[model samples]
Target: MIARLGDTEQTLDLPPGYTLVALRELGDAFAHAREIAAEAGAGTLVWVRRYDLVEFAVVLEPDEPLASARRAFFAGMNALADAIAAHCPPEREVAFDWPDAIRFDAGLLGGGRLAWPNDCAEDEVPSWLVFGVILRAAAMAHVPEVQAASGVSLLSEGFEMVETDAIIESFSRHLMTAFDRWKERGFEAIARDYLERLPQRKAGERRGIDVNGDLLVRLAAGNAAPERNSLVDALARASWYDPQARGPKFE
Candidate 1:
């Protein structure tokens, strides 16, 4: 049962269980969601209304400890990629840059971020988790033409007539599907989906996600141990985001 907070002209057709909290164009969906995540509980979605960006955040309550629960970030990334693939133009491709950055045809697109309570310990169950996403829907007039070309947007990538709302709506459904897969299959299933979107750096390199969300990489022919890439460090800052620009980086 998706419910709207107060009557508003803008609405989202989210999945049956989501609760909607719409924000103004200048609102920060991610920040607001984190502030109210405890009382909001799971399935609370906060969306920002903007013409040039697709921004939203969803609240979740994980059953497992914080260490393993961070794997849910992969689930969110998979759903974000899947949602873009659903509306992508033919011949265009969507891929990820390791832990967080998203790319379109090798150009930088926006990415997802995860947040939990400051006091939550690795072995303790977090009271709540928030997964937030921001994608460049259209090129902003304020951005310099040269800089704008360095990054990709839905409109720039030939996604004709794709409304920002459409992407968020699709994401809601895909996220539910992803969580369902986690319930029925396992976290490995979600990890597989995420790895599939990541571009391989070497021909014989194999990649896997660790129990605590670190990326494990190994050469197929080597007897050496797998190299571990820390998820915690990578997620500390979103590679694609430019804080000064307040959006995805242009390079």
Candidate 2:
């Protein structure tokens, strides 16, 4: 992994077992990575050169079945959080909203996404998995006055000192740390890290993540039962992201 990725095309000489695929800002790293993942195999990082957002995707080859392996999303999310927090001013708040929205001081920063072979079955080994992430380093569009109160960017949040390449490099290293921790400590550890980053819930409210990565929230009412949000279904409908628009939305 590089501590700094130079602008030159040849600046990305990665370590063995890793393949580097660079794309112009116009390219979609996530879609491209997924398209090439089966042939590229693990450790393939598809990175796009963009200043407004640090967008990239990595190829993963999981040994576990798709159902159990979906937990990898937590690892990526945790690493993404760590990467952002590293540059955040002390005490500046950052948190997650359920499955995939990330917020900073209660304002949106960006989120993560997961993709696997469409034909993958719960019991079958996914041919490949791609973990994609985007972080707002600079605001590309003006938030409407009404929505401005709920939106944020790294620059506005006192993270203007952070550069896009630095975030991606930090993410790659932290992602490796997260994966190692998950491999040794199990998905429980990964889930705990992810949940800890979520916004504080109401008092007496309990939250837990399901085996398949759904969010389970329980209110402390009599006969209270956990309500489950289908992570797979929600993620499939639409990403919280808009590639063409170049940002996220409340939708």
Candidate 3:
């Protein structure tokens, strides 16, 4: 069942026993979904009502533990980036800033987040996982002068015709494609797709994903030391997301 909070029309595509809820712009999809994820089960998509930002979260029931399943966030982020790039103006650059931030022409747009049951251990099944995402469709209204230089919007960046529904639809399809690639071609294929979206560094620098999902960068100076940041720990603290403002921080 689809529930509407305010003008927001959030729909849940439940596969029989699941329930869906929609919230207004004031609603926190990630926190709300995570709060009731256990009972909501799978197939729950909670979305917020915001024209300037495409905000939503999905619920998943994975068979793996939290640590391994967290990598799944990368799959979602990759697909989310792909969805944005599809409609991006040709030659417009889009790259990821480390683990969880997406940038367009070096400007902050939006990013994704993850959540699970509080008591669930890294080795235990958390019951359900919530993969949340947001996109800056348009610039916010009347921002402070100092903050103006930091934030950006798709409209300002030449993505004029994009819409919230279109992004969400494309994201769902791309996410499924990500999963298929992960299953058929293997995680390496998924990693390659994600890595390709990242902006290239200096000439001759190479990048690869380690087994644990840390970004391994190989510089041209004959340096092979891998930048081994744990994916699980990194995701725990989203660098781009600002909880107080309910959006990304442009620094």
Candidate 4:
């Protein structure tokens, strides 16, 4: 993969240990990364150069079992929202819908997806995990009032100066920072940062990722300890992805 900027396409400057693979405007960065992650190894960043969406994927080799490794997805999502917030114009609300959807000011702005080897078992350590990201940088058509009311693009949401390269670079940097914190502190650090950005939780309901990545929702009071949300189940299908169009679903 090769990255194309504007008129003259070039590789975006990535941090050390990161290999940049740039794809054409129409290439699917996520699919390609998923296909090649086993061989690509860690620190590989696959990016697609397109006008409308900033699409990319990263390869990671986790030191833990597949079950616990999936918790990294939460950290990745947190870093993504942080990267966007870093460049966001002041006071524009950014949040997550749950396990994996990102919204800005109550409008959809695309989200993330995770993939691993199909044969990998929960107890086994997979060869690699591919975390893919897509962000709507521009609206492809004339967004109707109703549709626009529920979704928005970066340009539509006051991000005129923001570009795909900048976001990707920022995400890589932030992801590194997030991982470092997780290593130094623990998953609690990642969970705290992520839960803080979650849209609206019922008051007194605290949420956190379990040892195996399942969502643990605990009430502040009552003997009602509710059932857990299986993170594996939630990530089995991308909630915000549109299978028919092979892109994000909005409205």
Which number leads on TM-score? Answer: 1
At residue 107, give the lDDT of candidate 3: 87
**Model 1 lDDT tens row, 142-211:** 8998878777888888776545678889999999999999999998899999999999999989999999
Which residue pairs overlap in candidate 3's backbone?
A: none
Candidate 3 lDDT over residue span 1-251, tens digit each: 56766565565343343355678767888888888788888867787767667788888887787767777778998888887888888987778877788898888888888887778897886688899987777665545656755677787777764445567667777887788789898888988878887776677778887755677787868755855667767777988887767777757
* Model 3 vs. true fold: TM: 0.85
Cα TM-score of candidate 2: 0.87
- Residue-wise lDDT of candidate 2 within 1-251, one digit each (tens)? 43234555523444456777888768788989999999999989998877677788999999989987888888888888898888788998778876787888887788888999989899998988999987777656455655544557687677764455667677778888998898898878898899899864687777778888888888877666788888888767545676557566643
Candidate lDDT scores, in order, read 0.89, 0.79, 0.76, 0.83
Please, what are the lDDT tens digits per residue for candidate 4 over residues 1-251?
24555576666767887999888777899899998898889989998877778899999999989989998898889889988988888988889877888988888788988999999999999999999999888765544557555567888777864455688888999999999999999999998898888854678787777888787887878778765988887877779887665567788
- Residue pairs clashing in model 1 are 1-16
Kindly give the stretch of ten consecutive residues in candidate 4 with the minimal lDDT sum: 140-149
Per-model TM values vs. the true structure: 0.95, 0.87, 0.85, 0.92
Candidate closest to the true structure, highest lDDT: 1
Q: Per-residue error at 98 for model 1, in Å?
A: 0.5
Say which prediction, candidate 2 or candidate 3, comes out ahead on lDDT.
Answer: 2
Model 1 ranges with Cα > 4 A deviation: 1-8
Clashing pairs in 2: none
